[model samples]
Target: MRTRGFTRCGVIFGLSVVIVRLIGGSTGLVCYTAVESLDLGCLLRWDCLHASPNITYTVQTKTQGDPWQDVPWCVWISSRSCDVSHVFSDFELYNMIRLGVHLSPSSTVWIKPHKFDYSDFTFSPPSVSVSLKNDSISVKVQFPCATNRRCSHDACCPISKLIDPWTTVTVYNERNRSDNQSRTVWTQEVVSTVEFSGLSPGQNYCAVANFSFPTFSIAASPKSAPGCVETGSRWGMLPMYCVGLALSLLFLVLFLAGFLRKPRRDRTTADNPPKPLATVQDADSSAPPIFVDPCDIHVELVDDHSSIDSFHGFHKAPTSGAETKRSSQPTHFDHSRGVTVQHEVQDMTFESYN
Candidate 1:
């Protein structure tokens, strides 16, 4: 009886070691959170033997009523963890989906579905950055798509290939909190950046981005906590405050410059007030001003004249000795009233009339 019991113990220990060797390694799951609220994303980790014949891992997922389905196109997983840098980038995964680990028929484990209440900010926080462009909010968020999976159906090795993770973005008025949702955008594309225009400048806005996360293996969310970035294009209060500050500084500078400049008193000739100008200058650049000797006194006044003509305007001289000169006083006439006002002239001189 003692010999038989020893034989059975040795057999059992050998079988256990054989099973561990066939499985390649052990896998553990942990999920946690940085905030007291529900966790956001999770991390999956395992030991990897970097050998010629690398160990392969396959993951499966299932919803409430759905049957067990393999994650898409993922033939063999080489990484030790499921993260942004791992196979998940190729295979989209999300939260609320149950995960199944399949290495071989002998080693398989199922994880419970991760339930996250994202409607409440306290429970599920968003990872996003907001900026103000011009009365608009430009939000940039690299939202992780569904778990990166490559579960292709091979004749030799069959797997599933279907990844669709819906991403939702929301821009809300901070005053309204989560109650008043101003705008919401939804897409499945991997592009992580979007813009929200037609926003009221100088208002408070909050941008939040939320998407499903495929979590397994981890009992807690990773240390990289999701964050929210508050910003606007041009209407946010912060931008408006900056603009107003700039304008105020400009006004202050102008005021200071005006105050520092000296003021001059109005001046008028006391002995001889400056004489008023008569003829306005024309645009002719060739005609130069003719200087008058101020001492010369002359006036050729006519009572009945054909019309007012240019003063001291010259005509072609008929005789060599006699210069053809036309002289007349500055005169203005009112034909309706038959009144003519003539100014007494001291002297006037010019070269040409054209």
Candidate 2:
């Protein structure tokens, strides 16, 4: 015949759920950079100076347009003997420039103009890229560059492993010199690796190789991707072993307690059993008396008469002869009317003859 045995399977299911949660919580992303833009060309320096509180010619010039313009020019004040030299054409383009002249003792001032051309400047990606490789895990990453600009013409832009894939590959326009000095400008952080993940075989991936920036960062992808780290059996087996051990210990304690104490209960049951009770009767009194010896015993004697004459109820002859002595001796006799006398002699022993 087949028989069903006791089995608890829920513990295994609960443990499996716990293991799943542990593995699921192990992978996630971190956002390191909140602001990702660098400003475009903005004026780094713009200044106006006034000379003297006096009603001196007080000639001042305001230069407008791009300050980085080169042209040779000079200015002279009619009221003062001082002349300003070395000015640029970009400043002269404006009509009726106001020049503020501060003359303490009438001094000549010299101005130096420096200009930069955009024709010679080029924007390049950062020089260094960081790639982390682990023997057991795989990663996916993308390198985003200026989308509207021709970023691929640069030489030796190191890319990630060929098998790696990229998404949201966007490129930004490089900022000009003016963008650097402005308070508000279209600026973006030059992000190197948009994503980082385990390496794959035969996949081509690209990351920005920074040239000058010393600090680099890594962050988790904002979007979810396939994250699976091949965890060994040991990771899951630890809790299972603990649960099994706890159950075994519990069962063992119960079994030992039952085993140790079961005999005492059995012995108690065996040591004491129900006994029969005797019933008392009202009229049944013919049973022979049963005697039990008393631990404390004493003997009492009853004497009927003390003198011989009283005992015999007769007078005795006072004679000194042998026959008289014999006749005078006391005798144990039976009384008339069927009366019998028992003589308890003073001696411990008594002799009788018939």
Which one wins on lDDT? 1
Point to the candidate with the largest TM-score. 1
* Candidate 2: segments with Cα more than 4 A from true spot: 1-243, 252-256, 259-267, 281-354
Give the Å error, residue 61, model 2: 24
**Per-residue error (Å), model 1, residue 8:** 39
Worst 10 residues of 1 by lDDT: 32-41
**What tens-digit string does per-residue lDDT give for candidate 2 at 1-354?**
000100111121111110111122344311110101111010111122222335233323335553322221223333422112112122113412222222334642222221212211112232323333432222322223221112243642222211111222221112222211101111123332332433333333333222211111121113322223332334555798899999999999999998999899989998898795444442234444444343322333444443344334323333333221111223233322233334443422221222
TM-score of 2: 0.18
- Give the TM-scores of the predictions, in the order they appear: 0.27, 0.18
RMSD of 2: 29.5
Model 1 root mean square deviation, Cα atoms: 21.7
TM-score of 1: 0.27
Error of 1 at 315 (Å): 74
